[model samples]
Every structure is written in C-alpha cells, then in structure tokens.
Target chain A: MCNHGIHIMEEVKVIEIKKSIFEDNDRDADNLRADLKKRGVYLLNLMSAPGSGKTTTLIHTINRLKDKIRISVMEADIDSDVDAIKIKEATGVESIQLHTGGMCHLDAEMTRQGLDNVSIDNTDLVILENVGNLVCPAEFDTGAVRNAMILSVPEGHDKPLKYPLMFSVCDVVVINKIDVMPYFDFDLDKCKEYIHMRNPKATVIPVCAKTGEGIDQFAEWLLNEVRNWQNK
Target chain B: MHELGIVFYIIRDVKKVAEENALKRVVSVVMDIGEVSTIVPEYLTDCWRWAADKEEILKGCQLEINTIPAVTHCDDCGKEYPTVAHGKICPHCGSTRTWLLHGREVEIREIIVPNN
Candidate 1:
C-alpha cells in the first residue's frame, strides 16, 4: 500500500460532553444575578403576549415608582425601537432598545449586553421588557431577579393551563385590562386558581393599565421586592 | 426561530470543546432530544447544517438526534404513562396530579472528532 500525504487516523475520538444546551446560559444567568445583587440592582424580566399591555403597564408602574425608585428600562424585540421610545417618552426613564436580530428569546448574555448601556450604578431597578411571547421567553433566563407576565382579560383565564411553563416560571402574574372584564368571559378567580395551581407562590395582581387602577399595588410589590433584594 | 438560536449555542459549545482538546475538526455531534422538548428534530438539523457549515471546525459535521419518549408520573395512582397520549391528567386515576417524569431535554451527548 502506497502511503500518500493523507494520514490514516488510528481511531475516532469520541468526547463524552453530556451537557444541556441551556447549561451555559443558566450559569451566565446565575452570575448575572449575583453581580446585580452585589451592585444593589434588581432586574425584573417582564413577559407577555403581543398587545397584552406590557408597555402600558410599564409606563404606569414606572411613572408611579420613578419618584422613589431609580428605574431604567430595556426593551427587547425582534426589531423595533418603538417600545424603548414609548417607555422613554412616557416615563422619561433611561430606556434602551435591544434588537435580538431574529432571535425569539433573549438569553443571559444578551441581557448582560443590554445592561451594559444602562447606568447600573445609579439605577435601583432595571426592567427588561422581554419580547412579547409566552413560550420562548420562559425557556431562557434573562438573569433577572424576578420574572413577571401580564395576562390580559381578553386573553382568557385558560392561558395558565395552555402555557403551563410560562405560568410556572413567573413570580408574578399581572392580570391587565380588568376594566374590560365585564365585556369578556374571563374569570379572575379561576385565573388566579389556575396560576396558583401552576405556581403556588405566584402573586396575582389585577390591574387596568388604561385606567391606572391597581397600579399602586403592583408598584408597592415592586418597591418592597427591590428593597428586600437590596437588603438581602 | 429558536432552532437557529439553539444551533448557535451548539456551535459555541462544540468550538469550546475543540479548543480544550486541541482538535481541528468534528465529524458528528450526538444529541438527546426529548419528545416533549418542543424542538422539531428536522428543523434543528436543518438549522445546524446551515450554521455548522459556516464554522471552519464544523464544516460538514453531522448531527444525530436520539428521541427520548415522553413519560408522565401520576402522584395519585403511582403509575407512569405516555405523556403524549394522556397529558396532565392521569388516565388510571383520572387525577390532574400528574407531572412529567422525563421528556423535556435538549442535551448534547457527545462529539466525535477525527483522529489526527
């Protein structure tokens, strides 16, 4: 046999790298959380479906808490500056837009990149308005101290049942558009029950972002959370 | 789609492994994809092909997926059943106190490198 320049390998080496694809992202998220904790900053990841009043709720909450809590916002969308602009214009908060290129979700690394632009030292709370989707956002941790989702009245009470993972991952479930509850078949109690079933420790708050009703409760919850996070 | 994002993660992980082992090229990557993992295997492989070819180390790398069957355990009946057939609710006891035992996994099992 004439041996050419091509060398015949002895054996193929198989490396046993049994690891989850999300492992790296999860570790990054934990590090980010710890860093934020050390800096006394609370990062809140807010997720919802499109047109679920996430922006409106944020504007309302930011307006109420801006005086007390030093707040900043990061809006993550596939491609849009509308949210960032709206949030900045509405609340006059330091807001930045993060385009995920074409990604459906924002991982911990992307969250950290977005946070780099914000003045983390002066900010007590940084709110990440995650891309409006239930499934993908829940799959990736954005290194936030808390996770919240707004379930509007028009979206029905069966959302928790349909998207169990989203419900399970959420620390708080904000039921927005409660003013239209009379017009819709959405049952608030049933919705709370379903949310509790998925996550017993989840705090459910009903709010009308349009009317500014129940915004105080949400604000109070957030203020206490930020205080507790900083203290701990 | 999420498949593209997942492909990027796989490429990053593979490149890191290659760097650690001082390997030049990878031949195949094996993955254990659970049935209820919500990742379509076809889409994943298609995305992997499009992304892997762009990487010098994974130019023609093949992705092999092992589908793990979805299983659910019933707390009430103390029994296990196929999750796809009966979801959330236990079939034997007709109870909603059922949780997934396994089937939501997206793991990279191994990588085969060509011996230099």
Candidate 2:
C-alpha cells in the first residue's frame, strides 16, 4: 500500500508538425492568391519544356486579348529577362522579369516577389511564365488556380507517357504549334488519349498561335475558368 | 541538377527541429529517397557535403539515404515487381497496366541531434 502511493508519469507530449519541402514557396503562393483574389485578378501558371513556344503563345494571346482585358505577365527564366522584354515589346503589357538563378523551376515565393515588383492594378489576367522545364515545375505549385502546360507537336507524342506527373498536375493542356503538324507525325487523337488516360478531367485545347487558330476557344475557356473561380 | 536546392530544404527542416528540441547541433540526417524521384543520389550526397560542410552546426553531419525502389503491382494477376525492370507491365500476367505502389517519395524521414 505504501509503495503504490507513488505514480509514474509516462505520458509525453508529442507535437505534430507536418511540413512539406516547398512549404515556404507554398505559403508565398497562397499569399499571392489571396492578393489576386482581393484585386479581382486571375493568375495562370504556364509550364512547358524548352522551345515549347510558351513565349510565342503569350505574345499572341496578349495581342488578341489586350483590347478587352487588362493583361500583365511575370516571366521566369534561368538567366535572362529576354522573354519578359519580348513580351513587353510585343504586347505593350507591363511585364516583370524573374530569373530563377540556378533553380530549374519557379516557386510561389519567387512568383509572389515578382508580382510585388510589378503593377497589376485593374489587371484581369496575370500569366506567370514558368521556367522551361517539365519535371521540377510540376512539383512546385505557385498557388495558381489553373496550371496550364504547353506541349508542342514536334516534342514527340510520348512525352505525356514519359512524364505522367506533369500531365496529371496540369489543369489545362495546350497543344501548341498546330501549324507545324503537317511536317510532323503528331496525331491529335493519340495526344488527347494520353492526356485523358493520365487525367480524365484535364482540358486539352489545340492551338496554332501563329495563325490564331483555336485562340478564340482558348480565350473563351480561360475566361470561363476565371469566371468559375470567381463564382466559387 | 538542383540537389543543392534539396539540401537547403533539409537544412531548413533540421534547423526547425533542432531549435524545438533545444539541440545545439545536427549530427546526421536520414532520408527515404524514392528510386523514381529523378533525383540523383550521388548528386544529393555531393550537395549535402558541400552545403552541410559550410554549416558550423552540422559540419560532420552524415547523410543516410535509403533507396526505395519503385514497385508496381498488377491488378490482373496480382504481381509485384520493380518499376525499373517492369516498365509498368506485369511479367507473369503480361499486362500493360499497373499501379505504382511505392517509390515517388522525397522526404527527410529523421534527424539525429547532439545532446544539449
């Protein structure tokens, strides 16, 4: 009875902190999203491999949509602001340049910083041109409502199979360079099949930005996505 | 190519854990690296040496990397095999479809710290 009077404390407090590798970037992206929502702006992360005509697509889209929408862009590259400069010259839209330094992808923190450096006042569309890499960019979510991927026709149809994760993460798949389809052996049905297999709900829109073919559908779809986001 | 970037993440996470535990230095880090993560183990180790060497609190910190193979399981015949060799197809059942059960992980599983 005397020995039973002493009690042993075996309950230790265990703190749970679930953090991701890109936690800092995710937080920054969230802040950017909140800021955009308050400003009534739509943010889109455009991703693709090198030479996928992402810059060219932007040039065309900005030219087409500038009349109706207040468009701004944040361009990400490894070393130069060449794309940003090109966009500025092409569309006369206020553009901000982001150099990823040595990183292959642009995180949300970097996007947020780039957005802060620019003036997006009364901007309806804000496109963040992600660095031209397929893999690493997929892992880094920049708090974009729509993650769009640019897949040029000549890059091979098996690209979606080689990198399924990127295709899976994308909200929209833009098949660029439809103008070059005559020279290449790119079958439209095969590409759509691959995308559907990876992500059934993903939007696949083929566009020849050079000739402005399917640009209207792309614009209308983007507007719908923004409107849907607003409604939500 | 950017394994150094991952090292920064490891350092940041280790610092947070060390601060909470009142540990003065981090001695070692254990990671469960998936085979299909596209991360080179040699590059990761090299990056760890370069970055971890620069830190005074973790100069001699050892990196323990456990390679997790990408294993896929076929639904038709119920076969499990390495993803590298299988190529998403089953050997016994000969199916072009299989689900990746493991491997795709890139996480710092544990950290060893010096006594306070």
TM-score of chain B of each: 0.97, 0.89
- Which runs in model 2 stand beyond 4 Å of their true positions? A1-20, A23-35, B73-81, B89-98
Candidate 2, residue A147: how far the Cα is off, in Å: 0.6
Please state the Cα-based DockQ of model 1 relative to the true two-chain complex: 0.61
**Interface RMSD (Å) of candidate 1:** 4.8
Per-residue lDDT value at A193 in model 2:
85
- Per-prediction TM-score, please? 0.93, 0.87
Expressed as tens digits, the lDDT of each residue in A7-35 for candidate 1 is 23335778999999999999999999999
DockQ of each: 0.61, 0.15
Question: What docking tier does model 1 reach?
Answer: medium
Give one digit per residue, the lDDT tens place, for model 2 in B6-112: 77877888777877787666656778888887779999989998888788777767777889899988888888988888776688888856778888777777765
Docking class of 2: incorrect
